[model samples]
Target: MNHFKQTVALKDVKCFALHGYYPEEQLTGNHFIVDLETEFSPIGFDDELGQTVNYEDLNSIILEEMKITQKLLETVLKNIISKVIRLYPFVEKIDVSIKKLNPPMPGQIGHSFVKLTYTPTN
Candidate 1:
């Protein structure tokens, strides 16, 4: 049997976070781009908020987690993914990506990013 695939996405969620390997980053902070895509359980064609993914909840989770101080984008990404999976069991698969804009580094660079994908085991 094959299950129907449905996706819910939150894209280009820009936020400011104090996460970096340097002291200046922790002090001044930087802009980050966040994107979330999740594969959720389907319950027919009902138009119920409870039966599907709530994007508000997803946004809140990312916003809340981004405030905490972290040394690495990977850690931040991991934490967000873990929290989302734990909070919403209906989420079967998820991909989260974080990009640090204008990273303070040598040479010219656009941004640094970290992405992680999670799939539940049943």
Candidate 2:
């Protein structure tokens, strides 16, 4: 069967996070940017919203994942991907990118981030 893929890109989703290895970083939350690309095929594409993924719900899922405290961005990304896949069975693949606006690195304007891709298996 041929599958139809729909790509959704949510860019620069601002949030406050305590995602870092240092104790101070976790104690004091900082700004974060999350980008998501969710790929899924709607069961019935008759221009009906119900037949496809609800973007509002998806945004909530991302926010919920961001609420959970984690040291590594990779872990957070993986968690988001896993939750998204679990919540939406039609989501065959997802790409997540997380960025810290201002990191604690010396002479650097911002911190590092991570990006990960997830694909569900039948």
Candidate 3:
């Protein structure tokens, strides 16, 4: 029997965090939006929580990681992926994107975003 994969997504998670290269940006903090997607193989169809990843847990993970200050969005994405993989080992693939709202720049600009996709070898 072939087991089908399931996907769980959490999008537009709003957060206020101190993450930036500029010292003033870090001190003032900024609005951020996070999106996460996870793909995993289900063990069964018995309507059990253990069979799939919980979106609430994913939200919590994002919120928790956002609290820790980081200079780069790449670091933030990596941290989130690591935590997710650790908590849900069954997750084979993870896609994460983080957007920094109203970034500090010379000209008027919108948010800047970084996306990362991770696939565990094991």
Predictions in order: lDDT = 0.88, 0.83, 0.93
Give the range where candidate 1 is weakest over 10 consecutive residues by summed lDDT: 40-49
Candidate 1 segments exceeding 4 Å error: none
Best-to-worst order by TM-score is 3, 1, 2
Per-candidate TM vs. native? 0.92, 0.87, 0.94
Model 2 poorest ten-residue lDDT run: 49-58
Instruction: Give stretches of model 2 more than 4 Å off.
Output: 1-3
After superposition, the stretches of candidate 3 with alpha carbons farther than 4 Å from their true spots are 1-3
Q: Clash totals for all models, in order?
A: 0, 1, 0
* Candidate number that wins on TM-score, 2 or 3: 3
Indicate whether candidate 2 or candidate 3 has the larger lDDT.
3
**What CA RMSD would you report for each candidate?**
1.5, 2.0, 1.3
TM-score, candidate number 3: 0.94
Q: Residue by residue across 1-122, what tens digits does model 1's lDDT show?
A: 87787798899999998999999999999999999888975866778887777889889989988999999888888888888887777788999999999899898889998999998787
